[model samples]
Target: MLPEAKPGPARRLVDAIRYGNSVVLTLLAMLCALLVGAIMIVIADPPTRSAMGYFFSSPWDTFTRGWHAISAGYVALFEGSVFNPDSLYSNGHTPIFGPISNTLLNAAPLILGGLAVGVAFRAGLFNIGVQGQLIMGAICAGYVGFAFRLPPLLHLLAALLAGVIGGAVWGGIAGWLKARTGAHEVISTIMMNYLALGLLNYLLGISGFQAPGSNQAISRSVHGTARLPHLLGPNLSLHLGIVIALLAALGCWWLLTRSTLGFSLRAVGANPSAARTAGMKIERSYVVVMLISGGLAGLVGCSQILGTNHALTGDIDAGFGFDAITVALLGQASPRGTIFAGLLFGAFRAGGVVMVANTGIPADVVLVIEAVIVLFLAAPALIRAIFRLRESRGGGVGVGQLAKGWNA
Candidate 1:
């Protein structure tokens, strides 16, 4: 046999460009999103708009006003998400901790929701019923939290467990339908979301679930014993759910990388026919993957109902289920990537409030920025063309991979 020749520097560089450009693409997408946001900010500013009317007479004034609006808007975002020098003199709590706390508080549920989506993606299943699963879990957890009372530790554990079981059962239903009946997950999941919402509305009308003497579609507040413990004292809203989310991410990392089941899942995802030929139980794998995915989504519910809100409301979802899809896509459906992406979205959530309050920028602009980011992520070919990056050899696990998995 002839000895193999090593790859040259040029070949290695090409390989890196092909396989290692995900991070670069992500950064450029974010920059482009921010630039788009800046334009919207300038357009929305009354002073900038007034200046623009007479741009030929005083171009510098228009430019100056626009720059000032953009800077102020982003500065508020930074202050709300990260730290504020002015917070040093704030009363009671530690300096610069409030913003960080808010970010963590918002990120906890997002991280869990993203993991729910990411895991299903890894198994070549597009589990789009996270919203429904999360709602079912919250319903179970909320009932357990208020109707029955145990010791503080036991009560919390029972509520959390109930949430997991509720979500798993809901997800398993979809899995079973797909496996046995050949029903498409996308259509089934979308239907389930509406079903879940209707169920919640009906339940909230009952005296047992509804808040006493209240006409709103909201459940009774959970008992203190069932509530997630505050992490940084009562001054901050940070809670134990953030710890749970991080631990869940760690567990998911192990589940997808080091476990035997992980190998089967990846194999099935890559090629179901080959996996079946290799003796893997494809049907069983589908059911199991959906169960786990739904369970993760349940944790997201726990974070909201038990950790933050302390009660289940009609708007309890707050669209986190749908946002999880964006998070999963941006993270490339990896555990570590999902964590970072969740944090980034959480920052957007935390900062957008301040940006609106301080800069008078419309709240819709924040949504616009988030939508733009997902737009770029969903179209990797567009990102490649914009950045002039080389495509990977064969095909890579980008949005196209996710789309391909839908057919699988």
Candidate 2:
């Protein structure tokens, strides 16, 4: 018998993608994004560009300068996000945990926002109103934080509760609309975001919410008693918001994996018609899940107002709600995955600042890297094709399936 023909490179590549490992694909995607970022860094560095002009005359110089530029930018990123031994003694002081502190501080709100989206995802809902929910929460929390005169602990608790309630109410509106009117959540939530923005702007211009005699659309500072306390020393900006975020993640994990409500929600997500046939309350689940989702998002507002900003502004959400969508997607709609994804983005944020200062690279480079990462992750097929990864044998959960649960 004739020997079997061997597979060509193209056939092998296609077969590899058909059986690719998701974890490997994700890592490879990140590496590719960084490689693209490194190319941008080299192009943007003046010395590196100049060295390249003399490549024929001095190839070694060009390569050395290019490597140095890339190394410096990445080193600064690490020092800014994680740690820097060189900072052990600056101005005759002890080592400051500024880098890690900044990373945590930046991550806290992201974690909450991501959990909000993740919870909604697990319940067969697409919550695009995280920005609106967060804004409303901030408005309510900021009002309570400044207008009230309760004692320290009471004031903080009241403010936090107010924020949670505000977000829940806003989210519930969309759920109600979907249940009662059969309206699409994606459309309703988007409209609510605009409404929330307008409401914030209006509130900031009012007497009670605006800072005393301030012309800008900024709310009064939250009372000191209501603000989240610093987790480390006064020198560090890190606060108890990180603790709250952690607890929220833990709660989400328990709720999804160990609770009856979680089972009901997951069942509904898996098949609404079947769940309804089995006597599950579909409308109630929608409303309840959205309420929970919005409440978690409200925690983001509290972290901003009570921990980081201490004041409410029209831009209080700072695009975090939208970013949370990316986070939820990257995390595969899992609570544990969301936590790690939030930290990764937080590191990007904290490190980007230092990278800019140290390497003179444009801040846009970081944004590009982030966008590229999301693009690759969202299109796992592209990752598989690029890396020539082998496909697995059995059917598995896919990103498209995760995203298209409700709509698809």
Candidate 3:
């Protein structure tokens, strides 16, 4: 054979750009969503209407007015989510770290839940029942937290263990059904969610789960010993939950990259028939992967119960499970990417509140923006068409591919 030609400098540059195209597209999608949100704000604001009317007549005044509104809104978003310089002097007791602390607090559960879904995605499983698993975890952990009083360290550890086990069992059921009966996880998990909700409602009515002298559907607060210690003192909401989430993310990275089990899971996800032909136990892999995924999701419940809420209520889930799917999708189902995506979504949750308070814009607008980003991410062809960009060498994973791999 003749000597092989190596890639030229221009080709290498193209390869480099293609390698990072996913991240670039993600950023561009966010920019487009924000721009659309700004337009909506302008259209919704009555003051902006008058400014628009005078655009041709008083261009300077119109431009200034529009700039002020958009700038103020985004500024409030940054101040609420990241830092507020004004809070340093105004709020004597509250430190400047308050906003960031809140962001981390919100991000903790999101990271855990995203990891849960991401791990399952890597195993060719759709774990849509994280909400149910989360509820099961809360039930077990809450019971351990309040029913028995052990030493400080042991009590917390026991509650955490109980949460993990509960979620594992809950998720294992779906895996078992998928393996044994050929049941679709999507249908089963959705049904499980309703079952979990109903079970939660029933348990809340019982004397043991119901708080004393209260008719509400709330469990008793956990003992002080079982609660997660605050990492940033009592002044801030930041807790050990964030640390746990980070550690879990690290563990997931190691598991998916370095472990034999991870290799099997990936093999099965890529091609189940080939994996099975190679002597991999596809059914067992499903069970084990789901068990681990459920455990991660359970940690989200523990974070809420032990780290923040300290008690279980009817609405304890707060839609974190559903939000996690979006986080995992945005992160491309990678551990590090999931962590960053969780933080970004957490920032939106924190800042959106301030955006509403400061600018009279509805908080629901943030949801719209998130939907737009997801839409753009889902439809890469649309993005490429709009931006006239070349296709990347490595394209992103899509929901259709995920679904197809389920039976593969």
For residues 165-190, could you state the per-residue lDDT of candidate 1 as single tens digits? 98888888898998899898778888
The prediction achieving the highest TM-score against the true structure is 1
The TM-score between candidate 2 and the true structure equals 0.91
Residue-level lDDT of model 3, residues 241-288, one tens digit each, is: 999999999999999889998889888887889999999999998889
Q: Which ten residues in a row have the lowest lDDT in candidate 1?
A: 399-408
Give TM per candidate: 0.93, 0.91, 0.92
Per-residue C-alpha lDDT of model 2 across residues 172-287, encoded as one tens digit per residue: 99998988888988999999999999999988898977999899989999999999999888888999999999999999989988999988888888788989999999999889
Q: What is the lDDT of candidate 2?
A: 0.87
| lDDT of all predictions | 0.87, 0.87, 0.85
What is the lDDT, from 0 to 100, of the residue 355 in candidate 1?
92
RMSD of each: 2.9, 5.5, 2.7
What's the lDDT for candidate 1?
A: 0.87
Model 2, stretches more than 4 Å misplaced?
Answer: 1-20, 91-95, 404-408
